[model samples]
Structures are given as structure tokens and as C-alpha cells.
Target: MEVWDRALTKRVDPIRYDAETGLKIYREDQLNLGKGGNTPLCPFDCDCCF
Candidate 1:
């Protein structure tokens, strides 16, 4: 249905985004997928990406 759907269905890629250039890319990696493993918890004072 969507690119994400295709990626997930295939399940062999890493999704990447570069905020500076607004570029998005995807590739395959068996060890990692989806939001990465551990991310720093959202900080209350941060206005970034909220």
C-alpha cells in the first residue's frame, strides 16, 4: 500500500533520513529495523521533532 508497507513486507532494509538535506533512503540490514533499538527519551524542554 505504501513504501513502508513494501519495506516491511520485504523486511530487508534500513530506513534512513537526513534532516539537513531532507533526503530519505532505504537499504537492507538483518540486524536492525524500525525506529532503531534504543533512542534517548524525548526531553520535555526540546521543541525538536515534536
Candidate 2:
């Protein structure tokens, strides 16, 4: 086991860790959802087009 994992296994220690936040974070688990399209939307209703 890795040094980090060994440290985490130390029972009776006050730490917050669960299955959802597992010891390892695989690349697949990380969701990279950026702006779907390059087109950007205006923040407010402007008459720039009109």
C-alpha cells in the first residue's frame, strides 16, 4: 500500500472520508463539461443587433 493509504488507515483518527470520496480518483470519475458551444451569450438584453 502507498504511504498515504497507510496513513489514512490509522483508525480512531478524526477524519472525513467515504465511498463517494474514495481514496483514489480515477480520470473517468472526473467530469470535464465546459461550454458546449463556442458561441457566447450576451449577459443582458442589448439593442446591439437591432
Candidate 3:
């Protein structure tokens, strides 16, 4: 959480996922990707976003 907050400098609302990466959450736009892992990674450089 600290890493993400430092990188993004904004609060995040993450959707958890179970995968080889462990805790995974794909950041996305509601219109473009529809959220979740199905959505592409976020444009931000935040660790959690990736």
C-alpha cells in the first residue's frame, strides 16, 4: 500500500485477483476496458497499478 501510494500519490480502489503474480489488480477505465484483469494495465507508473 505504501509503495502504491508513493508512486501514485492518490488513493487506489483495487480489485483483487488470484494469479502467479499473487495479488494482482489491473487498473482501467470504465468505458475503455470495463475494469478487472480483463482490462489492460493502467497508464500510471504505480507498482500496484502494474
Candidate 4:
């Protein structure tokens, strides 16, 4: 993806996860306290990720 090629400076082996398994990726403090911090990000108002 262009994001991987153009944005991140650190090399990372990206992992792909389906719906049930995808609940584990997060953008650090992207989540609130007491909640599962590893929530996946979805586009605003978009259902495509679901």
C-alpha cells in the first residue's frame, strides 16, 4: 500500500487479520482508558471495514 511505502520510516512486516481477528490492531492511544486498547480503525462513516 502507498501508506506503507510513503509514510512509515521504520520497516514493519504488516499482518492482515479478518473480522474476528482484526480486533487487535491499534494506533497507540487511539482508544480510551479501560477499553480494549487494540481496536481497529475504520474510515469515518464507512462500513467497508465491517
Candidate 5:
């Protein structure tokens, strides 16, 4: 699965997962959202607009 890394302003592929826990491993910095600011608005064409 692919997820956007908000801090890095780019996308990244998961490097590996813990087989027993099924947890994905990612860089800590890549997941942090600095200052916890306002949530980003959905794209104009997103289904939520309809």
C-alpha cells in the first residue's frame, strides 16, 4: 500500500512489516505533522464535494 508522507511532501513505499503484529515500519520523521495545524482541504473534484 502507498500512503502520502505529509512531512516529506511526497509518497513512500513501506519498507517492511512485522509479521506477527502486522505493523508497517516507516521513518518517524516522515509521519510527523509539524505544529498540528489545520486539516488540509479536500481536492475540488473529490467525492466529498458531491
Candidate 6:
């Protein structure tokens, strides 16, 4: 299992990430865990991780 699996199994929290970019975003649970959400969209136009 992976971190995501453990998180899911223990119901750790909700996580949201961008499909284009591999950035780990946070817009679900905050106080109890990870940080907050990222900008709706990326400001840069990088082809690697837009």
C-alpha cells in the first residue's frame, strides 16, 4: 500500500492535486492536516508540469 492507501484506509483526509502538474494541493482538510489549496490554475506555462 501507499501513503494514499493509508490515508484512504484511515480516512486521513481529502487531497486535491492538479492533473497537468504533479503538485500536491490542499483544498479539503486544513486545520487537522495538510496546508491549504493552491491557485485554481497555474500562473506559468511550463510544458513539464503546467
Best prediction by TM-score: 5
Q: Report lDDT (CA) for all predictions.
A: 0.42, 0.30, 0.44, 0.35, 0.55, 0.38
Number of backbone-clashing residue pairs for each candidate, in the order shown: 4, 0, 0, 0, 0, 0
Segments in model 1 whose C-alpha atoms lie over 4 Å from true places: 1-14, 28-50
Measured against the true structure, the TM-scores of the candidates, in listed sequence, are 0.24, 0.13, 0.26, 0.17, 0.40, 0.26
- Expressed as tens digits, the lDDT of each residue in 1-50 for candidate 4 is 21122233443333444588654454322322233324444334432222
Model 5 Cα lDDT, one tens digit per residue, 1-50: 66675545577766789899998887655444243434354343332211
Tens-digit lDDT track of model 1 for 1-50: 12333334553333667889756555533333443434455343432222
Candidate 2, residue 15: how far the Cα is off, in Å:
72
Worst 10 residues of 3 by lDDT: 30-39
Q: What does candidate 6 score on TM? A: 0.26
Collision count of model 2: 0
Please give the TM-score that candidate 2 achieves against the real structure: 0.13
What lDDT is obtained when candidate 3 is compared to the true structure? Answer: 0.44
Q: Indicate whether candidate 2 or candidate 5 has the larger lDDT.
A: 5
Residue 44 alpha-carbon offset, candidate 4, angstroms? 37
lDDT-superior candidate, 3 or 4:
3
In model 2, what lDDT does residue 27 have? 31
Report the C-alpha lDDT of model 6 over 1-50, residue by residue, as the tens digit. Answer: 11332333443333766789866564434322333234454334322221
What tens-digit string does per-residue lDDT give for candidate 3 at 10-29? 55555666677677564564
User: Where does model 2 exceed 4 Å of error?
Assistant: 1-44
- Model 6 Cα shift for residue 9 (angstroms): 19
Candidates sorted by lDDT, best first: 5, 3, 1, 6, 4, 2
